[model samples]
Target: MPVTGADVRRIALALPGVVERASYGTPGWRVSDKLFARLHEQDGVLVRLGAIDEPELREVLTDAWRARAPKRLVAELAEPDG
Candidate 1:
């Protein structure tokens, strides 16, 4: 099950203090006003976490890509109260 754009959006928005905005021609999600995630047009689903270094983020995201969203406990972790 692959994550959809909507799922990614939900995850990004649910995080506490997370802010959604457009940057670098993509939908960007930020933590404390610094970019922590983004979803690009090249990829149809999921987000690219920008807080971590490129290689680590890419590797983690690749793994998540297989697990999909909502089902990945992403929503659990993203909840404002969580």
Candidate 2:
């Protein structure tokens, strides 16, 4: 089943110290007043995954550049019943 905003809220609220608040006119989740997640008006939800080391970030970017979805998985998702 597809997830909804309420599902997101339920999960986020269960986390320790998480609080729901309005951020930039949208729903947001914060811990200790630090914004950790937010729902965008045009885009979908975003989560702050935290800072990564420079070297690790470089490697991650490089891997992303080479990544490709498997044809089978892509076809599955493209099906009407997916």
* Model 1 bad stretches (over 4 Å): 43-81
Each prediction's TM-score versus the true structure: 0.51, 0.51
State, as a TM-score between 0 and 1, how close model 2 is to the true structure.
0.51
lDDT to native, each model: 0.55, 0.52
The CA lDDT at 15 in model 2 is 48
True-vs-predicted CA distance for residue 77, candidate 2, Å:
34
Error of 2 at 12 (Å): 0.4
Q: Compared with the true structure, what per-residue lDDT tens digits does model 2 show for residues 1-82?
A: 3444565566556544557899999887766566655667463323222334434433432232223334453455456774
As for model 1, its CA RMSD to the true structure in angstroms is: 10.3
lDDT of 1 by residue, 1-82 (tens): 3555565567656554566788798887665456666677574434333334444544554344324433435555555666
lDDT of 2: 0.52
